[model samples]
Target: MSISRLHIERVRNIQTAALHQLQPFNVFYGQNGSGKTSLLEAIHILATGRSFRTHIPKNYIQTQQADALIFAQAHQEKMGIQKFATGEQLIKVNGDSIATQGQLARLLPLQLIDPQSTDLIDNGAKPRRQLLDWLMFHVEPDFYHAWQYYARALKQRNTLLKTKRQPTLADLEPWNQMLAEYGELLHSQRLSVLQQWQTFFLHDLQMLLPEIAVQIDYRAGFHPELGLANELQHAHSKDVERRYTEYGPHRADLRFKTALGDADVVLSRGQKKLLVMALKLSQIAMLHASNKETVVLLDDLTAELDSTAQRRLIERLSQLGSQVFLTTLDHVAVQQHLNDLSISYQLFNVDKGQIHAVEPTIYN
Candidate 1:
């Protein structure tokens, strides 16, 4: 679904802004510190109940403000979020209060491509695992509940390991059973999604990085032969030594590899960025194939990619029917590219804590 209206309040430099009649492509342009990124952050907060900029609410919420508010309408459904400085949040859909963020996420699936997106390749496993789980959460209907169960069980098991120095098998049996049950379910769901995602990923790789041969690998975080139950039983001693559960789906990772070595190690900085783009764009394509449209948040469109790459990226996104919100410093450059492709878009010029829509110029 695409957002038609967006409202923001008390968010970073943006004290208050209301945008209406958003098109398939919405471009925000301004100088540094012009609150353009904050506009995208507001929508990210509304979709996921958090900010991509900072984890702390006080950093993104305007100084001295009690909370930041974001609201949007997609068709007849309305979603809103209020994030307090004290780390409390209230999410609502269609004017009714909601308990979980998944409800909002299921309605509005967002794919974010920012300066930090390369962290997926350069950083450790958590971000990569999160990327995989985000796909599972969207495409797999039962993934969220299974993940909830596995996380709860994993937490209990870890707490037990920390508290009891010599807990016997019987002491950990119940939690282990729960973990194995849910963890195995999560593994199956993730494996199925990953297999399908790899197909789409390879196609995008060809289009975006044809010269590079990259392989996506999945580590299940457990012994494939022994299974989670058997592995947990075998790792009891190691678990006590480390004071945490070591092996399970919780530790799963996705490794990007090439003929020479890992993608991060073998590829240059620019190449790594393109690889990350392929990963995210492939995900959008996969979801689109299933008739689920994704809202893409692209921060600094021109900075991360060259002119040719930007044109290809925009063309791919347009072909997939994604509603895009992008930020850039050069409006003329971005507008020129969009005009050359004959793509319809709405432009908004952002200033210090304020935003104004710029009427589009017709080009023949």
Candidate 2:
């Protein structure tokens, strides 16, 4: 959803702020420690109902503040959250109260790239699997329900195995059956989405990081030769010993490699940034194909790019046609390149805790 209006209070350094007349592109520029990044972080909270920068909600509220709030209207739907220091929060979507984060996430489809984005490549497969699941959540309508079932069944199965006394196969039969049913659904959905996206996935990857030949393959955790039921049947005793189901879509990964083979950690920082950006672009393409619009929050997009790389990146973003909000500590250096792209934009200055909208800001 593309948010046309935003209301924020007691979030990070900003005590009160509201933005209207939001445009396709937004640039929040200021010097270091001027609260520029906090503005973007606030937008992120509105979209996903949480901050990508930190997991500690209390860390975000202004000091000496007991609560924080963020609300926005997007695609004619109402969404927002109010967080209290007592470890409680309320979420609203489409003017109705929402309890789970998934409910809020379903209302907003968003992608964020920050300095920590490189972790997508350098970290474990868990993060990579999450990135893929985000696509499945939006691409396939039945994914969420199927996923909930699978997670519940997996939990139940694990609980059976963790008893003080080791449980027998008979004890695990029901949950194993449930897990098998929904696990395969998840696997199938992810595989189909990736297959459909392969052509353009590689195209965007190669275009952005041309020097490296990158490849991504789906690794469904269990052996392909075995059916879910058969695999679970065969591993029953071992899983009982391990106290957990060892194989399923939960352990799946998008294996990334290069021409030289297995380039997970070998890519340079700049190259990794470009590759991550490319992946986000591919996701944007997928959303566009499905007739959905996403708000892209880019933090410090110019950090590692040279002049030419910077231009190419901005041009690529312009072509995507999504609402964008990006921040930078230096504005003058990026102004000319933005002008060359001929994209409409709104520029604002961030200082202390205030956001001042620049007048006549849309320069085409």
Candidate 3:
């Protein structure tokens, strides 16, 4: 799915902006603080009901504005999100109000690559786990429901553990049973998706980081032999001490390793970025193969990657039939690469919160 039109209001420095006839590849270029990134943020918010840049709505909402609005038309359906500074949100699809963000997210599956993307490697397991869940949520039809149920059970269990420091085994049985039922399902779903994702990931690794031999290691966060139910029962004391359910799918993680060590440790900064790109690109490839087109938001493309890497990334995205919205400081360089590849795109220049479509300069 691709956005054919987008309208934004009171988001960051962008007071109001609108674009029509967006192409498969859309490029936005400008200097620092020119609102290019803000434009991408608007699209991200519209799709996910949250900003990649910040968790606080007031931070992204225009200064002095009470709320920020983002609306878009994807194919025949129209989706919109309005985030208020008071932490309230209004989401609607096709002019009807919606209660959950998942409804909107299902309509638009977005993959974002930004300067901070390297955190996937260097940071903790949360981001990596999120990567896996993103794929599972899109590919596995039942994954979301399972995840919701598992999350509720996990929360109840953790709260009981925290409130009643010495809660009896009987007290925890119900939550354990719920956790075992849904947790196992989540683990199974994640493993199934990961197995398929690994094939695509390896292909992308060969293309993006051919020299580096990388392996994906998945931790189910519970002992496979004893199973989650038995483990939860056995770890009751530990859970009580920690005030949380420690062993479950909630703590699952994906680790990337090379012969030398973890990718974050062995690879250079540039290599880490490429590896992250490969991970995301592989997800796009897998989704594309399933006939689910992904919309990619690439921030500061030229600054984050070298020319060759940039070309390779763009080429791969195009081949996967991904609709990409890219932000760059050098439109000419990006335009030249797109021209060389004979890729059709819409070029826009962002300045002082204003966005204007510009004609591309053709080169021989």
Q: Return the TM-score for each candidate structure.
A: 0.98, 0.94, 0.99
Candidate 1 per-residue lDDT over residues 188-293, each given as its tens digit: 8888999999999999999999999999999999987888999999999889889999999989999999999999899988889889999999999999999999
CA lDDT of every candidate? 0.92, 0.81, 0.92
Candidate 3 on 1-364: residue-level lDDT in tens?
9999999999988999999999989999988999999998999998888899899999999888899999999889999999999999999999999999999898899999999899899999999999999999899999999999999988999899889859999999999999999999998888899999999999999999999999999999999789999999899888888898889998998899999998888899889999999999999999999999999999999876889999999999999999999999888888888999999899999999999999888977
lDDT of 3 at 341: 94
- Clash list (residue pairs), candidate 3: none
Cα-based lDDT at residue 280, candidate 1: 97
Tens digit of lDDT per residue, candidate 2, span 1-364? 6778888899888989888878777888877777878888887776676787788888998888999999888867888888876768888887788778887776678888888888888888998898899888888899999999999999888887887377877888898899889988888888888887676678788778887888887899887679787899899889878988899989998877887766666778888888888888888888887777777888886787777877776777777778888887656556667777777777788888898888533335
In candidate 2, which residue ranges exceed 4 Å CA deviation? 360-364
CA error at residue 328 for candidate 2, angstroms: 0.8
| Model 3, C-alpha of 1: deviation from truth (Å) | 0.7
Each candidate: how many clashes? Answer: 0, 0, 0
Superposed by TM-score, candidate 1 places the C-alpha of residue 351 at a distance from the truth, in angstroms, of 0.6
TM-score of 2: 0.94
Q: Rank the candidates by lDDT, best first.
A: 3, 1, 2
